[model samples]
Target: MRVYPEQLGRHLTPLAQCYCLFGDDAWLIENARSQLLEAARQQGFEERISLEQDSGFNWNDLQNEWQALSLFASRRIIELTLPQAKPGADGSAMLTGLMAQPNPDLLLILRGPKLAAEQTNSKWFKTLDNAGVYVPCNTPEGQQYFRWLDGRITANRLMLDSDARQLLATLYEGNLLAAEQAVQLLALLAANRRVSAEELSQYFDDQSRFNVFQLSDALLGNQQQRVAHILAQLKAEGTALPIVLWAVFRELASLLQLKTAMVQRESLAPLWSKLRIWDKRKPLYEAALSRLSLPQIEAMLALSSTLELKLKQGGEEDWTLLTHLCLLFDASAHSALVDTRG
Candidate 1:
């Protein structure tokens, strides 16, 4: 049976013999897996085995491990982490065969990225679905993202006013891990007190641990100095280049889409609604969009595409290229500021 991540907790009591937890979100996937493991332990699954499916991984090994008797515990939990989410013909057959006869003593957990629709409809997947639970862990965006943040704040026993929540939602937009850490930090520092937008600024300034989301915000908001400082910090901390590129690409794409829709004389309400762009963020996008022309946006998109390829090809100048792209925003914003001053 298929289940949502939130519903997994209740279903754990009458645990299925097998479960497939698949998604692209690392945070959600890890969180669900951790919960499942804890539930299995509570249900007397005392012995645990973990297998990472990678190059040279043998399907036969899974069978061997599954059939092997554990002297230490009567019940066992087997975790298979599939990075690619593709099980070859042989692996599929093995999995289906294993599920043919459900063993009450063995609990199987398969974790991986989001599977293609066709993959989900496969015979082996059907068998697993019939015999176990399938939970999706897709990353939440827009309102869903805000609800998640609200839950995190409540769970951490920290309170944030409307403005503070909006600020955080923008600051840590695509990075849930960072948002979680921020919530924890707030909980510790605020001691369950309600925090406002102005108060939160101090935490960010003092912490000096800006993430990709913050970098995107700074770039869009035309905070040149802040952007430069955050970029340097990210490089020093060895943040992955791909992550930074992803944030930049996402923002550029949004602006391009919005600009296109506006040019066509279409109502922005529908477009914003479809994009899941909340009221709080509408102003930010509008401000950035007003400053950026279609040609500039297109140029940036082209640059982003080239940078992505270069990064993939293991280019030595990847950092230099990324720095240059970031500074493009800085230069544009600086020019606008200078023009206004004159």
Candidate 2:
């Protein structure tokens, strides 16, 4: 009876007696719950009693509501919102009791935060899972995220070249809600035609709340505290780790190429134009080359490649390690971070 948000089928012409929607992705969870409510309403669930489960919640009220006749509608939806997804002893027993008894007139919806494995295995959850539909709405990552994005794109009938797709992904990787909004905008602006990355700037602005481009400036300028501050803001604001990683890696690659060219005593002006490092940001790169040795840049590039690969391969992010990687741009902190393996 378990279903993902995508597979909800808009389920229930004849509504299910009970439903459990739980997940970390608030957007997905909310959408799923709305589907259930709409489906329930279509099938004659005209009255809904929403109860927020807080410390002040009384289990007795739930039973009384269920037992008491609904003056408004014969068929009713009793939704219990468990903020932490954990219904303690009294709530568990009440839920189990309700499940044990069949009430054709009453529909139960238990909405909660993400489910841990232990909660999934619990007897009460087991009974509910068996009796009703359970939807796990965890955020998609890696290829799953791309698939989700592709689905969105296809739904909107917008064509994006590979570079355009990657550009879109980089712009709104972690925040799917924002990504969807961006996709909607693209549908309105650039639908039915393939677009390249370079073409995206005519319409799309950087959607990252923490301003990912600023991270590049901070890193290359060797502003250690500013880099840390921006990084912390990105993390706190739930910016995807991959987006920040992409920015840092691009700067590191540019630095490597420029530093190599400098060592060869070649003309740097043409290379600067090719690399798109104009007058304003040229000094930052120059300063970076002065501070970091060629080997150091190469080493950081290698580590960054490894980190990005780990993410692509579905590995958990190590934020502390990423913070250390950004700090590597500061020659003063680089040695200590390298020694401590930060």
Candidate 3:
């Protein structure tokens, strides 16, 4: 009964009696909820009673609402929004009881933040999972994000060449909502016209300014100044710190894996293929691998973890930590070049 966000649409026509949509991505979760609501409406669910879980929320009220018949519609939709994803003992008991017997007259939709493994494995959650569909709404990363962006462009009926797509991906890195808006804007400005990278650049001057991918490339290419400048630009643009950390951590992780493989005298072709690394990016990985030793990569990863901890502890040194990480890559590349010339 578990489904991904993409697969929720197909299941909507043949609606389940209940559904649980949980994740950290607000935009995606809301969109999926909207889709479900639309599907419910089409399926003759005319009455919707929404309940937001506050401190004063009573579980008995939910039971009452479920049992009460709606005069307007035979089938009703009950939406329960749990902001914390924690249904206490009473709530859990109520949910379990409700799911014990299927209610064909009512559709129960539970929306909430991501549930921890323990929460998901609870008896109440297991009961719901067996009875209804569970849709995950986690934020996409890397190629996943790219595919999502491409889908959005296609959905908007916007034609974008490969370069244009890459540019758009870079422009809206770590911000899917912004990416969606940009696609809509492009669709409006370039109706029935193919948008080239040049055109996209001209139209989205501010958004196209910088991206974390570019920063990663600069780090690998030993462009210290460019990396610093991009970091500053990304910070000024309010790019999420975690997004930047993820990009750098990903590159470092890739380099570490490749370096370890090379040390083991393993052919990298099959490994890269297994990793699903594109041929175009293979050279970037190669360049970084050649420049960074395994020990250096490990040290960088440890520093990255420290940065994460600092952020978690509410430290204001995010930019400082990120800048240091970038400079570490640049320094390693420069050191490698110097060693080669020696």
Root-mean-square deviation of Cα positions for candidate 3 versus the true structure, in angstroms: 7.4
Residues 216-243 of candidate 3: C-alpha lDDT, one tens digit per residue: 8887777787687688778888898988
Q: What is the lDDT of residue 272 in candidate 1?
A: 89
For candidate 3, give the lDDT: 0.83
Count steric clashes of candidate 3: 0
Model 3 poorest ten-residue lDDT run: 333-342
Q: Write the per-residue lDDT of candidate 2 for residues 1-342, one digit (tens) a residue.
A: 898788886566666778899887777878788888888787788999999889899998988878878898988999989998888888889888878877888889888888998999988898888888899988775478789889888989989889899888767765678888888988888867788888886777555434678789878888786577678779977888988898989999899889999999988988898999889888889999999999888878877876877788867687887887887897776566454323
Clashes of each: 0, 0, 0
Q: Which of the two candidates, 2 or 3, achieves a greater TM-score against the reference?
A: 3
Evaluated at residue 50, the lDDT of candidate 3 is: 94
What residue pairs clash in candidate 1, if any at all? Answer: none
Q: List runs of model 3 lying over 4 Å from the truth.
A: 205-230, 237-324, 330-342
Better of 1 and 2 by TM-score: 1
lDDT of each: 0.81, 0.83, 0.83
TM for candidate 1 is 0.64
Question: Which candidate's TM-score is highest?
Answer: 3
